[model samples]
Target: MKTAYQQFISREAKLADLPALVALEQACFNSDRLSKRSFKNWLQSTQRIFMVLEQGAEIVGYGLVIMRKGTRLARLYSLAISPTMRGLGLGKQLLIELEKQSVAVGKLFLRLEVEKTNQRAIGLYESMGYKVFGDYKNYYENNNDALRMQKAIRHYSNFSRLPTYPWYQQSTDFTCGPAALMMAMNSIAPKVTMDQKTELDLWREATTIFMMAGHGGCHPLGLALAAEKRGFSAKVFINQALPLFTAGVRSEHKKQTLELVEAQFAAQALQKNIQIETAEFELSVLQNALENGGRVVSLISTYRMDGYKVPHWVTITAMDQDCLYFHDPSVPDGHVMGFDCQHIPLAKEDFIKLSSYGKNKLRTALVLYPNFLNTSLD
Candidate 1:
């Protein structure tokens, strides 16, 4: 068999490569090895790409990338090289190939987690443009921590500036909207106090009829009205006029109440003459608002940051051509799989993925301009 460093070629992993991949997995890690079954599954999955580094008939390394259908980000599920192939630049070569494959499939960013103690791998990743974004405790089966790393493969623009703002975390799981609103409000109105009581009160005023669990989450209109009550001018953008959170409700009574609350919110928005637009907000609109000393509260699915399938609120503080910077109110889960959430930079397309919720990709956002100026923003 030819050595990987001697004359290596990269190709998609085929069924015949499974045995070699399993052997390489066993040889790479004492624990947390992917099984042959897993390799077969990944090889057959449409959302995943598994590739191998082959030197003639010998397979010496492999990389796996997992992507969601509508997301701009992909996760490097795993990478391994044969022990004898170490220090031969096979890992770097494999990484480069995987990133190319990810971008070819429409992913703008590629992220991964590696054992924190794996200094050699960390050095290789950093040398290859990957940056440590966060970490996870007890991430491996052997109880070893893992460091989260990511790199952008596609560049939308050259802009990379971030806005300065005070970060705030939601005290309760249901208060993400209010907490985000408070952060945006206090950042603009320095004299306003952003306390837990205000967070809860704003939530009380903005919460919808129900949530996927526990108390109902805040509605976009409700949050806009709450901001109006706080002396800020707010413009709303919603894809649908119907009440949200009606999808998962099992009882007709709950659905009816949700409809009523949504109607009330719509009525309040109209009464206040809040400029309501029924379309997906472009990046230019958000950029203009932020430039004019305003911030936006957007509803996103928690799936992108966390594994949960719930609507989440985040405050968009700044953006450049390449990335959108925001203050997420949720506390970071402190895991390799979870994002820091607060004051994080997301790729522009990733922000678009996170901004919409569910199968329909429903859009919701409230752009709160500086003060109480009832100006039409269309």
Candidate 2:
């Protein structure tokens, strides 16, 4: 007697299973594929859930759901099936499973991006009742545009009456891009005797500042002032070639504000004479600051596939021989509020090479000197 397809097991993924998942991802994606480190992060993320399908002890497929609180939508990050089993309805089955999982979590909508050129995949998505909501040009660097599709799972509710404290007031040890920004702004009081290890604390501080400032919920300049008061240095990285604003007053206004901030830092440098360095890459700027005998504090912007999407910010605090420590604002307070470093260490040369893969949009790192608030305008 043969076992039925329905008999194949499906279960939540484990850390030990990451190697197989990594192998499967490599088999399905190009060199620009998600890294093993990223896989580990996703596996450990509280906001994410992963499932795998197996047949007679062989892994055949996997799916991921990213559940974000304070928002009604859930994202289907990726769904993949083994090459040998592509034609079977396994992919559709995985999608159905994902829908069930997300709906159980109170999500009102499910969304995913499909390669526009993959007609077969697009057909599958559409047949499943997903409607094309938008087109993201060059969404995937390895491929062309991507079709942003959405499926309504429930009625939308207005967020006007919801309490803001539970979501925004919670203090996390480890932070993600958005939450870190809020904390950094709220916790700005001066400290004495800066810890040499404080550079390692850069992640949470930088992430909080950037997230709050960039989102317009808090003033960027005010956050910078608070960092100075708390004995932590700060800098804001701005790209000269964003191409979002043309030669006009809006562009000029942005440039002037950045320049004004830069002037304030320059004046601070003159007093303490602390060197502040800025670079296009977070790792590079931090490395430069360390080599020159200065601790680094930086704000880094996440890459933008489309301008309308939310961008993330991260901070860098300290660096050892190979690993750098900082905050990642995406995790809960227990995880994100403290200093963290790369689990997998990389050589300086290797880090530079890997960072190059996602260099499409303007990515800049702002370095700051800790302590002393100063104000300026230009």
Candidate 3:
């Protein structure tokens, strides 16, 4: 019979079955093996249910559950399988059966305890929609902590009705990561209107200093510092990936670049009594920073080859309810550009799609200061 069929039985154990159950329990548990007398008590108790699996009339596995009435909760007491039968999907099947029984008994939730070191068991529970609700420190004989996990059976319709933003816009293939778009929207816009002569002077000065620095594409950091030196709080926003890749290649090269820029601005700000913030992020990073009250400058690139080209930088000047206003460096006349922020709400699905385009090629950065007016350091 063992070779031909397998049987699973959920029934009360008889007095004669104690010796076999005790042997199985000893084989299953290492430190906390159950005694024959304890097995008998559990089997005879009306509040508990003992389930056994048999292959050809030989017991192979067992599980115990403590069913409590009025509270509508079921606690899994123990589950064990023979060493040879491990990873046969039997454990998951037993858990499913127990859940069905609990639901049939009108239980509203199911709970279990697993050791912290037991990653396999923890993963199984988590996959079954069980979430950690509490912990029992040093609960096991080995002093290992136990994680208490629970799964609710009730369906709450109200939870699913909460407001949600759409993932993408249909009219334009131009999409932004939800987090990146949010950061751009949340960032305070640049101020301090410059006359054409002042702007041109600042621009020429920045271009000269940046070109002499031999920093390749990192000229923006120098430009930002030059702007701050002249009594204006300067923010430089660039694509996030450029710095990340640079940092990865040189190991602190990107950090060193920002640190130099910040140090230069800090010295000038101190003399002029101003404050500044310098930061970086990829699309995802920007969203997180924005949600945390960080201000940003946005560098909007020119669309190229079905995507945005690099080297284009912009300073966001102001944000209305849904549109972001910015000064475009690529426009040749330094005109302030306006874009709809609502169309850029960063959603995960949309990010997954857009990020898939260049494989995280888009990047942005931010630099902020308390005051935009002070003195010209450039």
Ranking by lDDT: 1, 2, 3
Q: lDDT tens string, model 1, 69-157?
A: 44466888889999998988889988888888888877767778889999999999999878776677998998999987877778663
lDDT, residue 32, model 1: 82
Candidate 3 lDDT score at position 89: 65
* Better lDDT candidate (1, 2): 1
lDDT (CA) per prediction: 0.79, 0.51, 0.48
TM for candidate 1 is: 0.66
lDDT of 2 by residue, 1-378 (tens): 122368577778878888999999988877347678878988888776688888878888888887544333577788889998888898888788778777777665677778887898899999987877556676677758888777765533221121111112223332333244333332332222223234224333332222212422222333344355455566544444332112222445565654454455445544644333333545655677655544333333332211222333444434455444333444433422111111112234433432331224434443444344433200
Each model's total of backbone clashes: 0, 24, 15
The true-versus-predicted C-alpha distance at residue 374 of model 3, in Å, is: 46
Poorest lDDT segment (10 consecutive residues) of candidate 1: 333-342
Write down the lDDT that model 1 would get.
Answer: 0.79
User: Scored by Cα lDDT, where does model 2 land?
Assistant: 0.51
lDDT pick, better of 1 and 3: 1
